[model samples]
Target: MEHSITVKQQEVQKRLADLTLQQSRLSMIPGFSGQINAGYSDGRTNDIVTNQYINQSIFNASGQLSMGGDIFNWFSKQNTIAANRLDAESNSFLLQKARNDLAFNVATAFLQILLKTEQVKVNEVQVHQTLSNLDNTKKLVIAGSVPESNQADLEAQLAQDSTNLVTAKNDVILSILQMKAYLNLGFDIAFVPEIPENVSSLPITPLGEMDPEMVYSAALTTYPLVKSDELRIKSADKTFRATRGQLYPALTIGGGLSTGYANNFYDRNMKLVPFGQQIDNTFNKNIGLGLRIPIFNGYQQRTAVSKAKVNVYNMQLNRDLDNQKLRQDIYTAHANAVAALQKYNASATGVMAAQKAYDFATKRFNLGLMNTIDYITTQTRLFKAQIDKVSAQYDYIFKMKLLEFYRDQRISL
Candidate 1:
């Protein structure tokens, strides 16, 4: 999705390009200009009147070249460039954070599919067991060892188990679709994620003992999102400094050269000057410096500076907020991992106990010492215990992975 969809990645690329263009604009030579003009006039315009000593209409050609730099404005321009560069760097990190976030999301969705698939298998096993029990009960009824009235109840239980299996299969399908949505895959694209045959359980006590503060500190140094926030604060600081430059004066120096030809000017001999000689004789040069003091700009500069300062403050708060969130998430994940581990252990115990009870119930039912209602109830409890075990096991694993993620660890099954 990050590489192909390009929904988020293209935005980052565009921002980077914009910043780069701004940097280029800032580094450009301050002021360099040249111009050339050629014209023929009947001396009708006041500015192009024929020379007073001559009577011919005016014909003129001229050119000029000038170059200069804004010494004072350069400071502000360079500072603004530096600020934009920092912003671009921050966005680079943000892009990395975005991709990381996407990976985590996809991983979570994939885990959901795996969990749901396991649930479907569990449901299938329960339905198979229910059908077997129904068959044994039917045979018992035929042999007159049990009442026929029990067959209907057994058949109904079998039907309920089969319905549950169908629901479980649909759950798996829904989870798969959710995973596909995360991948930005088309509905027509079929996908089946690879899962290990078994996932070994990890000890949650050590994870619970881990310090959230330590994990948060590690994450702040390691995670791109944390680093991106820090960079944003720095970028805003630079922008604030750049905005202060508008309060200062701007200075520049430049010079120009120009020559013109006129058909009207006369030489020492009192004859009309040739166009080439007129051009040589009418050449001129000038050099000067300029300074622009910013008396006032309707408080626009002040407003910009104030806004930049506020942005800096906001960015600082954002960084702090991220830190707080990281700490909270780490603590929450640790707590959930501990709780899930306990639940899983309890479910495992329940499954064992239920298995024994179901075995006993089976023996009793086969011997005509137990009723079908009680046997079916025992079987349902056993199935529920097994499902709970699966749920808790996956829950614990996911929580543990979340804690690891907070510590800047990769999440993997």
Candidate 2:
């Protein structure tokens, strides 16, 4: 017994499945940046600073040497990171919506399957009752209390009951199969859901705690859709600023040290110094500064600024629309949940009465006080009541979940 698997081990397959799904939504930015540059100038390698003793020209106005992010590049990079995270956020929202829908649908259908199974049991009992009645009727016919013709009628009735039981059994089997399919589970291992004992015992209509304004506010300020749009707006603003940066002048300042030798430890410019003299030193130093502003570049930066502004406006409109939709959804769900819960509570009494009627009719028919058709009529009524009661159960459950979805309470399976 001690060698058996742990609870965590038993749940390993489930954990992997959940991880795989979450991983699909998860996204990460590199958190990485780098820049590299190398170049050479034709003359005076040592003069790397200016009159003010400031550093100059590690960079140049020389040949075209393109490199990585200056300040504009850095801002653009930050914007890109934000954009990627927002995209992941929006995707996560959609996945959450799907999860809610799946949970609601499974609960509804599973309840239906349970109700249908109960119905099959009721019908099966009726069929057996009819079979017993038919056998007795045959014996009575032989004893002359009923005529020979009654025996034939009894047998025909028995045959009909058998047919109906077979059909009902088929329905139960089909329902179970559907429940298995919805759960994404294999039917190799039999699964049976525990049905609720009484519909009246379920939660009643909940009072509306949120108004339309609250729903809209939450959607605009807290919902993933609005957050994604806000991220895009921030990115667009950064892009606009970065593009405008091209209009301003770029400033650079640098410095360097160099030493030269010409067949000896002496600079060519310092060649006049006597050999073997301490004056024959070979060293140089330099400093500089540079500035360049773009006069024009075929209006590319202007176009980019325009596009960024347009995107900002478009996103604003989209976010507003999303807020409106969120409000409408909450209203609908709240109303439905309230109505369904009340209706479900009211339907419980009908189900009880129907059950009593079916039981009474069955007893009366067996005691020779009621006909087979009367018992069957009661059976149909009971079936309808059961179906209605189950339907209301699911309707209430679905609406409750919908309410929970709006409240940001959807987490547990």
Candidate 3:
């Protein structure tokens, strides 16, 4: 799960969500700015105290600190922050869902490897049985109890069994490669999958206990995908409100402190004012409130409001769709589990029947009462039945595991 690309992407998404939430929070506070300026003026300018135009070369310095913020904008900032908070929460759920999905994929690959390994073992057993039969057939041919043709047929059957064994081994190798890909391991690495002694003994929730409706009900609250979608809908609603708030009037508060000094400044007595005294006299402080009523700006605000409204509707629809899909998936998994159980039961009965027939055929062939063709056919049937049983058992196990994963958001074995 940690090696999965999707999990890595989710990690990056979670970080971005956190950053977006932080940015929205920062927007709630007022903004401040400060500036300092100094220059030598050589042209005519107005005197600060006399308020009269005068021709003079003056050295001037000024500085200002100011702050401004929207005191009220129909709760736009608050709603935006709420929206971002919801988004961050939604992303967290999505990240968890990604992890769960990756884990399930790994489990599936591991199960595939196990299944292929079982097939290889079955094929190996078939090959050994065929070789043993060939040896017995050779003795019968040498004694003239069976014709030379019987030995030739057994040899051909042995060759086919060997070929089948080779193919099954190749399949196991391919399955192991697939598992390695899931683990993000290098193909060149010699890897051996640890097979459980008894996969059938792995823990699973009983099929009878997994009612489709009950599972769906539980999933609605427990599934991360559903939770994420629900949160996204709320986030969209908050965003709509924030966007709509932009179309209304806003109230803002601002304040500033500024002071300036000019070397050319003089008092009413016609004496040059000292620089320090000039700075003190020129100091000013002011505060004010402003109202801004949005008229029209190429319909940008209205367009944004319309888009936001549409987004809310889309989010709601998406949530509904996701819920529907979840229900369908749960029901489908339950159905598949039922089918797999039935198949496993049928395959088990077939293997038992085939085993009995093969045992009888073996006795008849040893007594020289059954032909080589008939004996080989019975053995092949038994082999196929055993393979089918193994396949069905694994299929049933995987299906049950899938349903259990849906219920618990985790998989074991």
Candidate 4:
């Protein structure tokens, strides 16, 4: 997940760089352009003074250097630059949100592995207890203190307990594999989940007192996903303004230095003028400002303005949707956290009761007062209670972490 997030971050960074480049290009002052041309021409004309037909051929060359810049269009250029800058900021927030989501996923997967490992431990303890009970029952039967059928029941319970333990171990392996998959690691990974040995000691905000409204408000301001949406809406607004600027008259100031040469011209001595002399004689300079008022352009500008408005509206809707989702997630996580905590507490009480009952049953079974089937039933109940406790503990932890995630806070064990 980390590796994938890094790759996505780089992509967002590249987009930011491109937007920055666009901003720089748009903000720059307009510069000059140069053009040069050479050509030959042939023509015929009647010389009215001589009243006769005449023909002449001329070679011509011209060069011009001009400078121009947009004077005014209601600040369209500035608005475009602003829009691009906003887009870059939006992507930056988007990248952070992506990273946060990936981190949350990894944390959730790690918690699952921890829970499965604890279940495996619980299963091991159950197996050991069943094995001990089986040995005691066999000794009792050998001494003729208990029936032979009692010993047979003990062996059957032992087999079942052993199978449960194996299944539990397989669950641990599968959970580890799931975590590895989230991390994008290979199956051969030597994965180990780090969790507090005493989860009850870990400090967590009590869900009963947590205010969903407060959390949602904080998330609206601090969460990158929410912030990204806000920035996108701002970008769309700027773009819309820029697009509307196109409807106004555009003005540009321009200046040019131009010269031309024609070899068919005559000097003072009635000779064809030299190229250099012709250029100097024809040199021209001018400065002017141009304005364009949009009368009609097949409604292109109107269409663009309408589209920009729609974009802004869509972005606003998206932001609202994100906020709604965030609220739903926080509320749901808080509810789950509360439920899980209740389950954890109930499971703890059940474990105590089952333990006492199992202890009593074990003594009775040894003295041949309780049958093998009854003892096995009590032992399985204890195992189940322990398993439930482990599950509830991890479930509460994950739900708490999920709430933290929505609050734009880092999740920790």
Candidate 5:
């Protein structure tokens, strides 16, 4: 999950949320600024102590420290902080949703590998069966019981079965590669996924017990996507309130400490004052409160308020859209699950009947009552039925897993 790109993207969102919350919290606190300067002046006009204009070269140093904070702004700062908090909360849910999605994707890839592996096994069996039949037909031809044409046909069938087996093995390899990609693993790495002996034995809720509406209702409460959207709407509302507060009057408070030093400063005796004394004498402190009534600023504040309001509406609409999509997905999954179950049942029955026909054809062929064409046809039918049954079984299992995931917010297998 950590290696997945989607999961990493969600992690970045979480980091952004932390930064936003930090910014919002900092906004509620006073901001401090300070500066220090030292300069040499070629000419000076005034003497601090003498209170007279003079022309002389001098060196001066000065420093100031000031802080400002919003005393009032219709609780704009509070609202902004609240909005950011909500956004952070929303990101948490989004992160979980990403993880959930990654988990589901990985599970799907794993199941694909399993299905392909099963297919390879089935194809191997078909190849072995064809080879055995070809060997028996060669013996029969030698005994003058069957024609050479039967042996040629069996060889051709063996070639086709071998090709299919190779293809199925290639498919398994491709599926394993896909699984590795999902895990962000190197293709060259030696890996073999552990396969369950009986996938159909995995626990799953019966389709009859899982109503689509009930699943949708459960997902609405448990799904991270829905929770994230709901939180985003709240966050957007807070943002709107904060933005609207900009249209109101604001109050602020500030204070500063300043001091300066000059090389040329004199007392009443017309003697130059020491740098330390000059600095002490020049030291000053000031404090003030400020009020800014928003009169006009090219409609910037109003524009901001309008945009924030629109964002709130957009968030609400997004929530609705997400809910609607979630409902549609649940219903679609339910339908697919029903269809997969039916297909699996039918395929199981078909495999049984095909197996019986193949066995009868095999006995008849050995007794010289069936021709090569008829026996080959029966074998091919059985092969197809087995392959279809395997496909249907895996498909049905995956569908059921998906439904259970939607209903419970977790996949277990």
Candidate 6:
């Protein structure tokens, strides 16, 4: 049992690893950069008109203090930031949804294994009872009291029952294999399902006003896909605003070094007027501000802004479609859960009645008041009732998990 427990724990841990995980954080860390640019006019003459007597050598030294966020760049940058934030949120919600779905599946498989195990046990009990009856009938045949035909009939019934028990055992094995695989267990592992006395009765929660409007309201703020769509819409809206801002004037501000140096300096010094002649310059320093304005872009910005708005519109459409689909699914799951609960109650009562019937049939068979056929029929009914009881238990559990999933409730095993 300890080994089985450890194996089960390890298996479940593997399944948990597969569950979708979500996290919240900024993708891009804020940063800054520093750079330097220098120009040297070793002996090149400027375009300035000279009297030839007033010699001049241009040694320009300046640096630009401009941010990447110009009127055009600002919109793109804002859009990118918005997209990153939205994408993060979208991914988080989607991961949460996937995890919830996996949790539901895990609960479902566990319950199915348990229910199938109970069914196999009931079948085994029925087979054993039939075998006992056959043995009793054989003893009577040896005394020459009961007819050999009765003994033959009992043998035939026992053979059929033994075959059914074998089939039921196989079914249990198959169920365990499927459950183990879902739990991420090794292929050679097996689980012996442990049953509790009875399932706790679930409270009756009315699905009265959970219509499209309610479900949408619940899902929009809850469901991962819907939340992702909402984030996309927000992202698109922000991107459109940033894109439109691109058409406006851009502002930049920066102040840094402006320097150039070679060897010497003078008033119009190092002057060599010959074309394609090599010369060296001295130190020069200067600082200034620069501004650029966009007069027109062949209407490219206009079209780009328009395209961004269209994307926002598309995202809105997606949100509406997702909301409608979510409502449909929630309603269906609610119905299934309610129906399963009803079946669970009915099956519980059936198990009690079938148990009493089997007990009475056993007493009658022992007193010779009931034949082997009658006893076997009673056992068959009891076995079916036990199957129903287990099936109902699992059905309710599965459907309940689905309902909880739509409601964004925490899952339990």
Top candidate by TM-score: 5
Per lDDT, what order, best first? 5, 3, 4, 1, 6, 2
Q: List all candidate RMSDs to the true structure.
A: 4.0, 11.4, 3.7, 4.8, 2.2, 9.0
Model 6 / residue 322 / CA error / Å:
2.8
Q: Which lDDT values do the candidates have, in the order given?
A: 0.79, 0.58, 0.90, 0.82, 0.91, 0.64
Candidate 1 lDDT, tens digit per residue, 29-92? Answer: 7676888998776634443234334334667678878777776663777777777777677777
Compare the candidates by lDDT and give the number of the best one. 5
Question: By the lDDT metric, which is better: model 2 or model 6?
Answer: 6
Candidate that beats the other on lDDT, 1 or 5, i.e. the better one:
5
Per-model TM against the reference: 0.84, 0.55, 0.87, 0.81, 0.94, 0.64
TM-score of 4: 0.81
Model 6, stretches more than 4 Å misplaced? 1-74, 144-185, 188-197, 201-221, 246-307, 352-375
Clashes per candidate, residues 3 or more apart or on different chains: 0, 15, 0, 0, 0, 1
Q: Order candidates by TM-score, high to low.
A: 5, 3, 1, 4, 6, 2
List candidate 1 stretches off by more than 4 Å.
1-18, 21-28, 31-68, 201-209, 255-287
The digit string of per-residue lDDT tens for model 5 on 1-413 reads 86888889889999999999999898888999999999997765776766678888988899999999999999888999999999999999999988888788889899999999999999999999999999999999999998999999999999999999999999989998988888888999999999999887778888898899999989989999999999999999999999999899999999999999877766678777888887788899999999999898999989999999999999999999999999999899889989998999999999999999999999999989998998999999999999999999989889888888888888788
Off by over 4 Å in 2: 1-226, 243-300, 356-371, 411-413
Model 1, TM vs. native: 0.84
Q: List the residue pairs that clash in candidate 1.
A: none
For candidate 2, give the lDDT: 0.58
Local accuracy of candidate 6 as per-residue lDDT tens digits, 70-173: 32345556566666567666766666665655566656766766666667777777778778877887887798666677677777877887887788788778
